[model samples]
Target: MTPDLEKELDDFKLSHYENADFDSLTKKTIQLYNKFERLKDKKKQNRVVLDLYTLYLQATEILFINSHALSVTVDRFPSALFIDSFNLRNFISENFAKTTELSSWFFKLIFSVLKDNSGTNEKYNLYTNLIKEVAKDYLGDYDLLNAYKHGYRVKANHSQTTLSISVGNGQHFKLNDSDSTITYFSKETRDGVPIVLQHTLNFKIGRIFGKCLFVCSLLNNMRAIILLHYKKPVSSKDISSFYINDKDEWNSMFGGSHFKQPVFSLKGLNKKNAIPK
Candidate 1:
């Protein structure tokens, strides 16, 4: 946490003394703190308490950053922008380099960068082909988040409200959305794959910072496509030209020009669409 951030939040606690939402945040903070306070238990209670604490702290940080990131502008701190969920799209299009959600997975940034810096090449061609295939999978069309955690996703409808994930050891991995979670799993509730992934993920990151970093990585994947579009090298109108039928458009205006020249240009476009200054 930055010192300036601490001062600002402290000022917030002082000024908005009557706001219930801020009060709720404070009370939740205290309640969560106290849960971690007298943790005399050494088994399941300890783990549950710790995970809750971890979630609480990260969420608080998210709230804090959202309200302040743009305001804390400075010249010397380039690394700070890497975590900014706000200005991320700028990194993809310009020469500026920052870790963004879309390319959170390795090799994702390659296609966008290649298309921008160079005209279509073999590598860019392969990546563009792959991107079209992956784009269908990433539509995020409502049920996407609903189906992500569950093997069988709840079909999305306007009636569906919150997108929930299975917490805990994954014992009560029921799909009916009824049983909520009954503390730690006792091996009698679910005892299945959900528990497997939870436990496996636990083994990967055993500290607070590690877990938060893992979450940042997840943020990179969770909202990647929205990030991709904003960060794309060229404007969307340019993208249509690449997909227009090369053969069909070839004969219209620049007919017989294909054998003469195989490239697209604004002056050559028979239609008003493909022309760029």
Candidate 2:
């Protein structure tokens, strides 16, 4: 990387700081981006460095947005849960190794789905908020996935578009919902079930951006999964505990802030299990 490139990256960092509604950590992410960009230019264009950098920035923005967005999204709901990124990353990496087979598969699926997937022609500015690449499946857990949601929803609803994935090695995984409603009820269903999604690696967006994660969210008998998964895993208990009015956030949650707790299942009954109806 030349001095000019470094200066350009520095300028990019300044712009994100001067422009982005991120946090101190996010500012640090800009620095990380600069470092990674330099490495990417010189280190033979390795994709891992770029992917890690993207996850770092995305997660940072999510942390900031979760704090800020929640305050305004619902006054009654408690402020965003704050935890150090180091600790949070450690938590995710640790838990991921121990997660169930389905969960691990799900995390891999989210990245592959997002990575191999593309097409954002709607009114939503997801293109700017999200980028595509060989989406990495590191940090496979709920927190990182939920963080993606909290951050992206700060502006748009991704559920506005349906999740299309090739599950179980081209088994065609479909998130059971119409396009518009998925993102609308994101927070509620992201974790209602036992499955979780991890981190994603995407095409370089010049360095300063966030990663996307996923979870399951539901609405009025509608069961759907929200991906671009994030950190900040919200339990059914936590979301359930929050008191919501008759009105839900039109741009966010559907049914008041309060939600129902559903039993999580790591095992499932596949078709034709010899059960006669």
Each prediction's Cα lDDT score?
0.30, 0.31
TM-scores of the candidates are 0.21, 0.24
lDDT of 2 by residue, 90-149 (tens): 543443234333234333333332322333222113321122211122332234334445
For model 1, the stretches where C-alpha displacement exceeds 4 angstroms are 1-20, 47-51, 61-65, 68-277
Best by lDDT: 2
Candidate 2's error at 231, in angstroms? 31
The 10-residue segment of model 2 with minimum total lDDT is 215-224
Show how many residue pairs clash in every candidate, following the order shown.
0, 31
Model 1: per-residue Cα lDDT over 1-277, one tens digit each: 6889766654443333222133233334455445644556645344444444335344434432322232243332224424553343232222112222333333343234323554445434433433332222122111222233352322111111122358788744422221011111111113221111111001111122222333232233222322343453333322211222343432222100000111222343455554222
> What is the model-wide C-alpha lDDT for candidate 1?
0.30
Residue 136's lDDT within candidate 2 is: 20
Using TM-score, give the best candidate's number.
2
